[model samples]
Target: MQIVSTLRGLMLGLGISLAGAAAPAQAEMLDLEKDELKFGFIKLTDMAPLAIAYEKGYFEDEGLFVTLEPQANWKVLLDGVITGQLDGAHMLAGQPLAATIGFGTQAHIITPFSMDLNGNGITVSNEVWEMMKSHIPHENGKPVHPIKADALKPVIEKFRAEGKPFNMGMVFPVSTHNYELRYWLAAGGIHPGFYSEDNITGQIQAEALLSVTPPPQMPATLEAGTISGYCVGEPWNQQAVFKGIGVPVITDFEIWKNNPEKVFGITKEFADQYPNTTLAITKALIRAAKWLDENDNANRREAVEILARSQYVGADAEVIANSMTGTFEYEKGDKRAVPDFNVFYRYYATYPYLSDAVWYLTQMRRWGQITEHKSDDWYLDVAREVYRPDIYLEAARLVVEDGNAAEADFPWESDGFRAPQREFIDGITFDGRQPNAYLELFPIGLKGSQKIAQNAVVGG
Candidate 1:
């Protein structure tokens, strides 16, 4: 790992102050148990925090040496962290929760920092878009924004009537893309499918079959006519528009406003073994997230350039800027100002809220990934185990003490839960404190004592 020799000199050259007026009288350095670390990530724009931390010397500011490597996919990245091949990785918000609950890979993964929010979109192939366009409301010769999946329901029905199965893509089974796409489809009265202990395929009783496609492969896969549409993170969704093969119908922000997306995940053993190192990593990530959202996103243009490099997201700067700069182009020329499209720090985004973890667990149970009902307290317990707000607050306090951030920037009194969120596309309310009751409101998912059996939902 390459260590920056003089972090103060680097900051000075960058023309940024290391201290603020509210900074403590003395800045303290942590005694890191581990300084040299390599982290992994997928090639998505939401990985910007990791890139910025390394490029802007945030890691060095904490006397740490770091390397960021892009992994092939979410599984490889998770496996890397579990096997100790990587210290940590940019992870799907669901990855750590699923891992901790022994869903996919049984490991005690914990997240100290949430990466970013609302950077994903659901896009359809040109043919499907043309079919759904007429169903969507229009104004001034353009499709209205937040095109509901109701428009796609008829299209899927048409496919079903013709004895053709509609297929869609998501990055992983436990990904936010899957849940968001499922949420959108079900809200529109389209059955996205379900998972069962007997059927891990998740396509049992489906209207649209959802499958996994790596982020970078989504556009090409759509173009190949393999899947009619997909839900994935930026530059890929924008890549489809740039390639003129598909049209993004709605962003995840429209599906659920300011939703928690990715996280900075490390193993529980790693945190226990190197407590200060974990705190340092979280501090650096918090700083990077703040930089990404600071000054009303004045730095996004620079962030786009950094993310466009070969080692980062590796997409064209223009493609990345389409969303990173706060305006998202949905249908080619239909660019709209979506300033909060990719929130990294604002609205307490970096804080690993326990409610965020509970939300994912609710989705897992709703879709049969949990295989059975769990108590609401069980959900909160798992969240408390995996989503470490204590570590996040400690890191935030240190960042404020260093004078790099203001004390007001962190949510000092949060009880690890946000107020009940009511912005879901279905207009359903989700209270993290009442996971089971929340699940009961969803019309198309497993709830209560319900479980999937023999390709049918049974025992409600």
Candidate 2:
């Protein structure tokens, strides 16, 4: 375990002087409803916010006691939140959007906090890496960073020529891992098929087959040659580097800068029933986020330790810190500094932007997961429902009012984002308000109410 002393200093320094301010006369005292709470998370490093909040006493400081539990799968985790077995969980940015639209399991779940950005990587087996290495251009015999998927194009073709299907793994269908992997492959001119609800064809006609593999089993699955490569969250991708079984080709930050990854999700009913508790939890999370990003990520090493405990992420501190401590390992012994790789606090990481929600909706429409096309207004309405910026603002206001945070720490005048972001590997600039125009930019997706049946010639 990498116990960074500097991180301790950073967290302690930023620790809020909540003792100074009294509960305001006008402020509503947080109704102490459901003081003891259970939250769920998959065993991924980005769940750091929840772990850090508990470990650093942030939760208790907000007059809330919380227990964190590891969930078996994404579906199970979502179900727990819906049924109130768990108040919330670390979730895919797409999960709430998918559920609200009746895609898989319809539920009215929403999020106010986006956990972090850009903490995923694509890794290939050592044998496959060697094959891919031949095509990649190098500078001074060192493999390039942000390696494109073009190099793997020929490898997949070779497997197809030999009558073998090229298979890859992602955490889940609606997961950021799946989309990031698809985006990387497609940007390199490799077609990663599509899904139409009406079409029973499980095959999306992808050039390289994509499937789901549990995070802990990713390395084993790759070692068994079941999957040539995979897109997954930390410690898993970093685990491959430690085992020397694989080399990470690209990080998601390289694919799309500052892409939204996970969210702290809760049902709308839960929020309405316990609004004060809701704000209290959000307050604790805000403090934890501050601790993580304070002093330019000096607290990450300590956070990695807390996440390593058996009750939380339960991974080795070294494994967790490999990516958590502002660096990532690709090939064995090839460690590089990637400061924003596992961001928890900076760049308003705690703020859940409506544009982030819209982006995920656009991806769903792009891939035919959303069977019908809707107008820009519809997109905004859905985004507004799921991504609660108003609630977040309220929480931030309370923390600031309580002297737990400075007024200068937040974006008081944030216009969601400065401009249309154009950093994607495909170079597509996405404007959140213009979903229809964005849909028109894609070459391989449905747009303008284009139905799957219309594209098929029955007798051909």
Candidate 3:
């Protein structure tokens, strides 16, 4: 009887031990400054990190209860963050820089994490595509990847000769789309022109006639034949391919490899006041980024489903998946695998490198959004102010300490990855540390102290 009783006790103890071993470690409870959080995003696939963080309970995991709202447009979203109507937002890669530099709205917006990469494409209307196609070199009966704007140069010149303006659309003046469109054009020896104090809005001195059109409105504007082509993020670009009304000539990835796209933006005041909350949000976003890129992007299909929900990108699953799930359609029925088309986690995409900030600043200067000729130090100072690596390091450290990620995730010893990147479609290498030298490389843009002429200002 005693032995049987002892045996029963031993079995019970073993069972308890097994149960304890099977349980997952409890994540550290983060103290959030604001629990009822309002976040904003545009209807784009790159906004997936925010959606995944919310839907996957990553924010909740960090003790944050967030409400995601879709904003009317980029300006509204930026204004929302600035006015405290929204706590933070998924912002254009250039927003923080522009805001800090007083380009559009003057505020101290900063980004600690880059949202995603390679999510934009340049789409041409059918008429423009038809004309440009003849000039594009073909290989094996397919248009070459990283198709340069050289093909479209003749088309623009033809329009010029016919006494008609060649207009193109970008989401906003400070958007990556605008700079990329200009970059591609300049690289192909087509002058996309400059903007200065004389042309503060950057619409003047135009050769290709670039202007702002919202992302959702891009396809419709193109379909209406109001614009010949556009540079915007997906699924608008993919929408063009699906509608068979336009063709995506090139991706921003081709414009510049793994280029910085969007950022998780918040005012510096908010971040300074709620340091813990800021880190917590960053932690959640880091998890979302990992999920997006883990297992060689095995989760992208699932991500597309979440983004398809009305609260998020609000686009069709197929439309989001066309680019998000490792494939892109240049023309209708010309879908090809482009695995790195939308990177979230890999290549340290989440890391807010100072150089990434400087690159955008360089574009601002090149196109005359930055009117004054600032030194390399001025550019670096602005970049460092807007791109807070301190906050990023804190968030990354917390993730590592929590064992959710490893030390191998970030650059432990470096000066912020400022190496000369040489994989652009134009084959131009950009060394962010050397802004003047980099600017001088481009023949079509303003270099050191170069200003636009009075005649260049259209409506100013």
Worst 10 residues of 1 by lDDT: 17-26
**Local accuracy of candidate 1 as per-residue lDDT tens digits, 438-457:** 99998899999989888888
Q: What are the clash counts of all predictions, listed in order?
A: 0, 0, 0
Residue 315 in model 2: lDDT: 78
Of the two candidates 1 and 3, the one with more favorable lDDT, higher being better, is: 1
Worst 10 residues of 2 by lDDT: 1-10
Give the C-alpha miss distance for residue 62 in model 3, angstroms: 0.8
Prediction 1 TM-score vs. true: 0.95
Query: Model 3: per-residue lDDT, tens digit, 1-460?
Result: 0001132245466775322321154355566676557898898999999989877767767766677888889999999999999999999999989999898899999998889888999999999989988888888888877788889989988999999989899998899999999989888888776777756656666778888888999999999989999999999999988888899989998889899899999999999999899998998899899999999998888899988877777788999899999999997888888899999998888989899999999999888888767899998999889998788888988888878787998775657755789988888888889888888888777788776678452221
lDDT (CA) for every model shown?
0.91, 0.82, 0.85
Please, what are the lDDT tens digits per residue for candidate 2 over residues 1-460?
2111233344348894433222343244476577678898998988888888877767766656577888888989999998889888899999999899888899999998888888999999998899999998887778888789999999988989999988899988789998899889888888776777775332466788888888878989998999999999999999898888999989999999998899999998888888888888888888888888888888877888888887767878999899988888888888889989987767788888888888888888777788777889989999988988778888899989877788877777875643699998889888998989988887766678774554331111
Candidate 3's displacement at residue 310, Å, is: 1.5
- Model 3, 325: alpha-carbon shift in Å? 0.8
- Say which candidate scores most in TM-score: 1
Instruction: Give stretches of model 2 more than 4 Å off.
Output: 1-29, 199-202, 415-418, 454-460
